[model samples]
Target: MIYQKTELGQRAMKDRHAVEITRAQRSALILLDGQRSTASVLDATLSLGVSREDIDRLAELGLIATMPGSASADMPRGDAQLTDFASSTLAARHGPMDLPVAPNNEEERVRRYKKAYPLATQITATLGLRGFKLNLAVESAQGFDGLIELLPKIRAAVGDERVQPLRDALEGR
Candidate 1:
């Protein structure tokens, strides 16, 4: 899901807190502007050998957290019920976000697919040998639509799976 810098992270960024980190790690911290998904940040940082691990390290350091009201599993559930999107709701609400926005056409779709593909694979990869069939499904999901179809099952298998790029891609955000 989307990540917002924690107060600690913001403080570290602004005051140059003595969190020992490399340049790439700093760049990753800069990218966590609370609007971009984890995968989106990772995709942008791919040329830098990906700051994915850096992002994780930052999160572990209490430097970043999933956006509030976004159904992230890590978010403290103060009283609001988090609805699961891994079942019938997905089928019933494949709304306009599901449609390829008419502007960028196939290129836009492809770019979204590329950004989302790895996130999907990462989620499935965590499933291990038990996910052999699911892994095959991911492998077979050649296009954006195919992957979109499998989103529910992926979520169902991995409760509260953190794959915001996939959701943003689905909703055309």
Candidate 2:
């Protein structure tokens, strides 16, 4: 079976390992869908923070697996819809209801930040009714931008009746 790391799985692994992992190791393990070889895994580990000895030890301990050459008929087919649904649900429930950190790459960063903004706004509006205040630092443009970006979504999420007070506050009315 191909193993792809879920966010929860990654958190569990990190908590269990408790050791710092190299970026390369993280990338390799994430991409391992049961097809990459030991050498590739090793390279990935090396790229991350792990030594050869550690990689060997992990493999020996059955933490990492080497894919066999033959494909198994019993393996589940890739379920894109399921994956998307699960990811969205997880993100909504567990992910920070705020702009994510700048992504590793420009395109991805923009995409994720854009996607997270509206969701965050919606969540924040729900919280605002309970008197949760937003914290935006003077030195952080991104923080301010995120707050401003979320205003419209928050308004929309709150709807006309519940959002008037918020709008009054924002407009100093």
Candidate 3:
């Protein structure tokens, strides 16, 4: 999922509000625009020492939120009947602005997987046990075939009761 700064984040940026934070968190705050995906944010801030932990922390603090992937992400931003909150807010505050252009779908998916690799590795490290070496396989796997090979093992590790849900998530169902 993509992440973006909340109104609180906007306020923080304008110095209208103050939130005690680390240098890394502050750097991350600068990069947390509505347009960038989580992977993009992570990549941009890697050298600044902002990690997923910081993202999670900011999320917990209500300073940021997950932007939907694919199209229609903005629908839930405001009331159910209104998907215009983002643009409306911008227009109200700063006057007219052009609508955002959506990125090409395949390219966005590739970017997502590239970012997901490290997170997958982290999960494997957390859960891979006994002779199950998902971390190594996840690190080495190149594409769909590699992911397919690992699915059963992940299912096995997580167990029958949990496997279907896990599979659905992995497949983006």
Please give the CA lDDT of all the candidate structures.
Answer: 0.64, 0.40, 0.55
Order of quality (TM-score): 1, 3, 2
lDDT of 2 by residue, 34-127 (tens): 5654434433333133334444444444456545543433222243233222222223434422322333565654554455444444445354
For all predicted structures, in order, the TM-scores are 0.40, 0.24, 0.38
The local lDDT score (0 to 100) that residue 47 gets in candidate 1 is 32
Residue 18 of model 1 has an lDDT of 58
Instruction: Assess candidate 2 and give its TM-score to the true structure.
Output: 0.24
Give the per-residue lDDT digits (tens) of candidate 1, residues 35-67: 877655654554343334677788898888889
Return the top candidate by TM-score: 1
Candidate 3 local lDDT, 1-173, one digit each (tens): 46788988777777834776677687787887777765456545543445566776888888888776535342333333422332333333344332222235766545545654555565567663531345677778775345545544444344444444434434544
Model 2 scores a C-alpha lDDT of 0.40
RMSD of each: 15.0, 14.5, 17.3
Off by over 4 Å in 2: 1-28, 70-173
Per-structure clash totals for the candidates: 0, 2, 0
